[model samples]
Target: MAPPKPTAAAMADPSPWRSPAQRGRDRALKREAVLKAAARLFNEKGFHATSLDDVARQLNVTKPTLYHYFRSKDDVLFECCRMGLEMIEAAAATVPGSQASGLERLRALMEQYAEAMTMDFGMSISRTPDTALSPENRAELRRLKAQIDRALRGVIQSGIEDGSIAPCDVRTAAFAIAGALNAIAHWYKPDGPLAPAEIARQTADFLIQGLAPRTSERRQPKR
Candidate 1:
């Protein structure tokens, strides 16, 4: 006798069927993959030198597949910069509500920022300049950048007021700390001797140390 035919449902259903949530998650994952690939290429080749085709080829996807997630190369770069800014902002947000001392909170925030910079999104932010983006994007990026800087400055100010950190020029200190942390994206390598976590710890330690009150200075608190 001939074998029975497959059920209509079985025949129609696709292999590796996904639920609605799963499908949404899959799309999110694919979009992130595109962004990461684009970031890496943009960092290595510079934004102008890297094209959509390069990103697509790097991800083994067609240009149209990229279009499904991003409208253009500029869009991808904008998202990359936005991702970096969001990461820093998220880290900064934790500082205000934490029970830890202001200095401790600042240390945590700095470490978090360093780790973000070590990632692809942060690397793209560091490598790509504001001028590389559209005027609107450039303005948004500058606004986000200023937000992060202001947050850092606020933390420093709090630390000083609370006596957890030494008195210093808050603006200059914020700039110095940010400049150091942002530079990590330029030189950090996944295969480098120091891991991201270790780099974060070390960088935080160095930055925090500068803000530490000297024993002599601590004896006489700033009025």
Candidate 2:
């Protein structure tokens, strides 16, 4: 038998338009693509040196197309930094849920943090200076960074309490770990001698050595 005739409604409008939910998802994806491209450009060339046109050219789109996704170059940079911090925070969050010893968990988190440093968004965080951001954006980034620091400190405190990590100042240790990881963004290049994973592994191992448990006489008082 022949197929039944199409409905009049379907014939008039065959639903070519995306539904609201699909439209929202598409918009989000496009925005993310824009952010990723902007982040890479910002990392390759200093944030001040990279413009919206540069990002648009990299994406093979018009600068006006970027304005649809981001307000301006400053806004794009802020969003890139925000994305980077979120990635680091997400990596750190995994440690609290793991059953590993405090030191092991800390190492895992550090490795993740190092891996993120090699990504475009993550690199953008360290590459962009606070002075480049608007005052409001600068304050917001500092707040997020403080939150990340607290998370790192919490892990250090746990390691110390469990006696898996050397007894020392949590505040100072967290500062050092974060500083080292952030610095990775500065010197790391895709063409670097070591792969990102190898770099991360080596970096984490080096950092963890300082936190390794020590003899009672060797351990310093936990502060």
**Which one is best on TM-score?**
2
TM-score of each: 0.85, 0.90
Report how far residue 130 has shifted in candidate 2, in Å.
1.7
- Sequence-dependent TM-score of model 2: 0.90
**Residue ranges of candidate 1 with Cα displaced over 4 Å:** 1-23, 96-98, 217-223
Minimal lDDT window, size 10, model 1: 93-102
Q: What lDDT does the true structure give each of the candidates?
A: 0.90, 0.90
Error of 2 at 45 (Å): 1.1
In the range 35-129, model 2's lDDT, one tens digit per residue, is 99888888888888888889999989999999888788889999999989999999988775546778988888899999999999899889888
Instruction: Kindly report which residue pairs in candidate 1 clash with one another.
Output: none
